[model samples]
Target: MTEWWLWMYVAAMAGGVVLFTRWRADPCGVPLSEYRVAIAIPLWSGFWYLVMALGGGRAEVAGHTLYWARYADWVVTSPLLLVALTLTATHSLPGRRWGLMSTLVGANVVVILGGLAAELTADATARYTLYAIGVLALLAVYGLIWGPLRAHAHRQPKEIAAVYREAALLLSVLWVGYPLFWLIGPAGAGLISSATTSLLFVLLSILTKVGWSIVDLGRLRSLSGRGRLTVV
Candidate 1:
């Protein structure tokens, strides 16, 4: 399918980013905690992008159409993305916050997987129910960010706290696109073609995965190289 070819290019770009991040990580001279998680996100993402390109699935219902091997990709990559975000944002969170973060990450998974389920189904009632549940789970994720997570980030060393705050903002804004595109893109209302969906997806990945990694690398460098970074 032509869609497959288009995604192949996207996957190549993702793969290139993975390599570039890795190369950039070591030079930063700090044990950037973000890299381990960041690398896995794109590594898995690129794999699924390639898989979807070559062997993707399709569904159409109520005028909504989807090339949905991308959902399967999200099933794995989405969780990893949050994992990186939580760990980066909570760089200095206490032991208890770890448990809270885990619960939030679990909720995030349900949200993405539930969305995937919504896409795969053709029943209007069932689809909307799944979407509603997914939305609720995603809200729980936002709730945690503003709740316990925010408290911890605020308590961290001021400069480090600033980095965490910026990372949290990026996570919040970039991830909101998932549901937005889902509603308007090929998979939900057919307002956009699958190519347009893939392009948007590509740009989002660049902004989130690649962009976040660069931010993390810079923060780590600040912490480890210049000695200006602080943690408490």
Candidate 2:
């Protein structure tokens, strides 16, 4: 558990950096049609970092640390459901894409909150892990949806679709990879494996976020090339 927390922190930090850097670049700038979605990305990413800094889901001597941190972590990611729903509402995403994103986000949100409730009330390990696996599986599904979305967006120029797709893809892929570490690792890999895996997860997450930022920056540059516009 200690090792797991460490790795989780690393992953969270990486994801946060990627998000913050992109925010710094102001790719979407202060306002736009998708301002909520744009702002929410970094906000959620920062919460992820807060979760790690707070030491999520670990058994401290007082247990309060993990208790509070875990809830914070859940809350941090919960906006994903809202974002997914809003995106689908736009009707810009295809049927399959919308359905998959909605299902993944909806299901994960339910399971996560339920698991947290169960943890607080009953302290069930199996339930938590099972729900976690489900979350991981959903993330993988997200990756599949994102790939097609990315392709679809790239087909059109000067649309926010491509940038959104890139961000979504990066986030989904990193999460998918993080869960795979737990499912595929050896039975008794112990601290070393857990810590190493956790670190790698963080690194990948960070890289993915950063990658999204780069794409957004490129898009901004392209947008700027059209004309010099100052913020109002």
Q: Model 1: which ten-residue window has the lowest total lDDT?
A: 24-33
Clashes of 2: 2
Count of residue pairs whose backbone atoms collide, per candidate: 0, 2
**Model 1 lDDT per residue over 1-232, tens place:** 5565557556655775666576555645434455666666667667666766665555565456565666766776667666665665566655435677678879988997888888777787888789889999989988888777777777767777777777778778888888887877765776888678777876776677667666765675667566765432
Badly placed stretches (over 4 Å) of model 2 are 1-57, 60-71, 78-104, 110-169, 184-192, 208-214, 217-221, 227-232
lDDT of 2 by residue, 149-195 (tens): 45554444435454456556555555555335534432112233534
lDDT of 1: 0.70
Error of 1 at 85 (Å): 2.3
In the order shown, what is each candidate's alpha-carbon RMSD?
3.0, 7.2
lDDT of all predictions, in order shown?
0.70, 0.47
Best by lDDT: 1
